[model samples]
Structure formats: C-alpha cells, structure tokens
Target chain A: MFFKIIVFIIIGIAGGFIGGMGMGGGTLLIPLLILFTQTDQHLAQAVNLIAFIPMSAVALIIHIRNKLVEFRHVLITALPAVTASVLASLLSKRVEGADLSLYFGIFLMCLGVYQLVSAIIALIKKKKSQEGKQSAENKRELSENRQD
Target chain B: MKKLLKKVVVVVCSAAVGFVNGFFGGGGGMLLVPLLEKVMKCPVKKSHATAIAIILPISIASAITYIINGYFDWTSVLSVSGGCIAGGAAGALLLKKLPTGIVAVAFALIMIGVGVKLTFF
Candidate 1:
C-alpha cells in the first residue's frame, strides 16, 4: 500500500503535468496505475474518468481565463465524443492489458500525428492568407501608380 | 460588469467543456485544463483541478443521458471511480512539485497525439 502510494504520487505528478497540457493523461495514468496498484483495468479506466473530474476542472479554469477556449466548437463535438468514450468504456472490460496498452499506444501515436499535421495545415493556411493580402496590396499600389 | 460577463462565459464554456468532456470519455479534461491555463490565464494546478470540477456535472448529465439510452456500465464506473479518487489526490500533489516546462512539453506532445487520434486513428 505504501509503495502504491508512492507510485501513485509519481504517476499523479506525471499525469497531472501531462493532463495540464491537454494530453490525454490516461495514456500515462491507466498503464501506470495498472502496473503499480495491480488494479483491474476496468477500475483503472473508471478511476481515470473520475480522477479527470478534478484534474480537468483545474485546467479548464485556467484555459477559460486565457480565452483560448471555443465554446461553440466544444458543444458541437461534445456529444459524439462523449458517446464514443462511453461506448469504449463498456467494451474495455473484455480487453487484455497488453492489448489495451497497444491500442492506447496506437491511439496516442495517431493523435500525435494528427496534431502535428493540423498545426502544419493551420500554419500553411495562415501563410497563404498573408501572401494573398500582400499581393492585394501590391495590386492596389500598381493601380495607384498607373493613375498617377 | 466584465466579471459578470466572464462568469457567463465561464459557465457556458464550462458547460460546453463538460458536455464535450462527457462525450470524449476521458480527455476533454486535458483540453479544458490547458485552455484554462493558457487562455483564461489560470495557474496550471488550479486549471487542472477546476477542469475536474467542471467535468463532474457534465459527466453526470451525460451519464444520465447514456443511462437513459442504456449505454452506461454502472459497475465499470463505480470500480474505476473508487480507485481514482485516492489516486487523483496523489497525482495532484505530485503535479505540484514538478517543473512547469516539463509538464507543458508533455502536454503538447499529448495534444499532438490527440490530434492524430482524432484525425487519422
């Protein structure tokens, strides 16, 4: 129990930091809890959800203050995403530990790839918009020179 | 007046965050936490804790929605939540001691992961 407490704390710190940054902390927490606490996977998943209650609240408050949040988008996506998560939770009980970890790892890797890609896309789009604006300005200047 | 407006935004945002949080299952909390930290100017630790607090009502509401439609596993939620309460406190304290930068990078990595999962996986 004492050892578990120590491990839990370590996991928590790591998870909290990861969680704070908006990474699915469960990627770290679920495996760590299972390994250290020797707890059941379902329990770990449930614990992950429950723990998120507090963990997320703390983080959300900060994000709210910073105005980085998009409430409308959140609403649009919430139902589908929550439904997926709940459905996944139901199915998780039948899964094996290693299999679950593999799936989760794949999920994480895929998620990482997506973020990198989207950020690139967003950046590219921004650059294009800027270029478009500059070209428009150039055209305007040319017209003014022709008028003169 | 601005404070009042901000409060309204917070509630609406929080509700949306919660609802979306409930939908994603486990991770919208991560999104909300950092948004709180970065956008809302909340301290890192407080943002995390607040994310959880905001999530509860949303989860409950969503869970009820699930339950009405017969989607929940009461047994699973009970078991996992039981262990998580204790684990969370430890995680919270542990979070307090770590360097902020390490935490931030890890989060960014995770976001990248989430983005991948959402788009490709």
Candidate 2:
C-alpha cells in the first residue's frame, strides 16, 4: 500500500511538473497511467481531471500574482468554456471506454504530429535566417577588405 | 462590428477548447493561448496566464461531472494530488531555467507513442 502510494505520488509530480510548465501534463498523464500502471483509461482520465483542479488553481494564482491574467478576457472565455465543458462531459459519458481511449489517442496523435512538424519547421527557419545573416556579414567584410 | 466579431471569435474558440478539455481532461491551455493571443489581441504571456485561470473553472465543471458519473479512483486522486501540488510549485519555480521547446518536443513524441498504442494496440 505504501509503495503504491509512493508510485501514484511520483506520477502526479511528473504530471504536475509538465503541466506547471504549460506542457499539458494532463494529456500525458492519462497515457502514462494507462501504459505504466495499467490503470483503466476512463479512470486515468478522471484522476487527471481531479488533479488539474488544484494544479491549475496554483498556476492561476501565480499568473494572477504576476499580473499576467486579464480578467475581462477571462470572463468572456470562462463562461463559454464552462458551458462547453459540461456539454463535452455529457458526450464523453455516452462513449464507451475503449472508444473513448481510442478517440483520445487519435486526437493526441494528430495534435502531436502537427506540433512536432511545426517545431521542426520553426527550427529550420531560424537556422536558415541566421545563416543568411552570417553570410551577409561575410560578404560585407569581403567588400570592405577589397576596397582597402 | 469588428469588435463584436472578435468577441464572438473568443467565445467560439474558447468553447472548442472547453469541449475538448471537458471530454478529455487537462489540456485546454494549448488551444486557449493562441486563440486569445490572436483573436482577443492579448499578449502571449497574458494569454498563457489567462489560459491557466480559464482552465480552473472548466476543470471543475468537468471534474464534477466525472465525479457524479462515478469514474473516480479516490486512492489515486489523493496520492497524485499530493505530488501535483508539490510538483506544481517546483515547476513554477524552475520555469525560468527550463527550455520549454525541448519539453514540448518530448511531450509530442510521448503523445505519438501513447496514441498509437492506445488506438491500434
């Protein structure tokens, strides 16, 4: 029992760390729980949802303290977000467990691939711009030396 | 007209994030930040910070439904939450030091593997 508790806490810490970093820890948590701990897919999703309450609260407090949050916008987003979340929850409840996991998996894959490709492209673009600037500097230096 | 259109965009975009988060749990911030930044003209930092704030209520709404629906594993919840709070503190503290780009890449890979396993296997 003690060992199990320790394991669960460790998983939470990892998830929290990722989430706190704004990496969407809850998304990763579900699969980690299911793959490593053999937790049921639906159950992992529920636990992550519960844990997010506190985690997000802490993050929000920090953001608020830093004056990063804009309340007027928050109000606009929050109401619609809450309503849609309720509707989504209702839909999720109707989906069977296997299908739920499958859907979740598909969502992740598409998002993941998209993000990864974007990141790689961004990196390439940055490198290309740097090289271009460096070569431009080299050309300028060559012209100055030739004149001298 | 343009102002009202932007406000409407905010609601529509956030609603999409909310629905996905409500269905899955724990990932609306990604969708929220860009929408707020582009549609609402919020700065990136403000968008991220606001996304965190927006997440809390939506999470509560989703979690309540999950609880009522009887999907909880109390033991995991209690144990994990203990770690989550502590880890959140640590992550926040280390926010300046970490390279989020690397983390994002790693996260993407993990998601790919997990998604494949869940779907086909």
| Decoy 1 TM-score against native | 0.48
Query: Candidate 2, which segments miss by more than 4 Å at Cα?
Result: A121-148
Tens digit per residue, CA lDDT, model 1, B28-118: 5655665676556766655554555545555554444444544435443443444444554455456557654444454547545543443
Each candidate's root-mean-square deviation in Å? 11.2, 2.6
DockQ of each: 0.11, 0.75
Tens digits of per-residue lDDT for model 2, A27-120 = 7778878777778766888899898887787677777898998998888899999999999988888898889889989988987887687667
The lDDT of each candidate is: 0.54, 0.84
Instruction: Quote the positional error of residue B73 for candidate 1 in Å.
Output: 16
Task: Show the colliding residue pairs in model 2.
Answer: none
Q: Residue by residue across B1-121, what tens digits does model 2's lDDT show?
A: 9889877888888899999998887568777877887788888788888888888899888889988888888789999888988887788778889766676778788878888988899
TM-score of 2: 0.88
| i-RMSD of all predictions | 7.5, 1.4
lDDT of 2 at B118: 85
